[model samples]
Target: MRVFTVAEAKAMIPEVRERADVIIRLRANLAELSLTLNTTGESPAGGGVAEMKALEAHLGEAIGWFNGHGIEVKGIAPLLIDFPAVLDGEDVRLCWLEGDERLAWYHRTELGFAGRRRLA
Candidate 1:
């Protein structure tokens, strides 16, 4: 529940984006493995189950990195993340989505991404 200033949150974007990319790639790999399992009705050769486990663990580690930093990871497919911050003396979430060039949106603590308003 740590709160960050806008400058602090913005400074974290590069590392956050890098980790988010790793999660995105791992998720894609996991989805592909799931498709293979579904279509073949059996695990692929070369220890696919173990590979999937490793991927899942790796993904968890990436997500945990964010949580450990007091950042919230909200989605994986499109890589959404939020940083707790104080805006105008009230708590808000500084939101960032994959492909965003910077931390440019935010919403009140009670709202989600749908309520995001561009930073002024």
Candidate 2:
């Protein structure tokens, strides 16, 4: 898995949201794929690494396509992407808490999710 610094993950939102609709669809599909393949209780059909690679490929494609359209992407950490982003200019980790409706958790790069504070 690839861990990304908070800075890296935030820079990609423009491109990511440019193709946000597509990304949402892909995420759903990927989740289904995971469920199906993970049913064996071992790992996905190709294993965890392969599954992560596939997601990376998909996200990379989306980012590339969007970037081609003039959307600049930065701060996109697949390994650590945990929730919807608010896109302020701070280097904060995006995460979803157990009960938040949308992504309402964030932490400084040095702190990480475990150190996330509420967004109120």
Best by TM-score: 1
Candidate 2 residues 8-120, lDDT tens each?
54455443444565666666667766776667544545566577568768967865664464333333432223433333665554653322334445766566666778655
Residue pairs of candidate 2 with colliding backbone atoms: 8-75, 8-76, 9-75, 9-76, 10-75, 11-73, 11-74, 11-75, 12-74
* Cα RMSDs, all models: 1.3, 9.2
Which 10 consecutive residues of model 2 have the lowest summed lDDT? 71-80
Tens digits of per-residue lDDT for model 1, 1-120:
889899999999998878878888999989988788768755666557787788899999989999999999888879999999999988899999999999999999898888999999
Query: TM-score for every candidate vs. truth?
Result: 0.93, 0.33
Candidate 2, residue 20: Cα displacement in angstroms equals 4.1
Compared with the true structure, model 1 gives a TM-score of 0.93
Off by over 4 Å in 2: 1-20, 30-58, 63-104
Off by over 4 Å in 1: 42-45
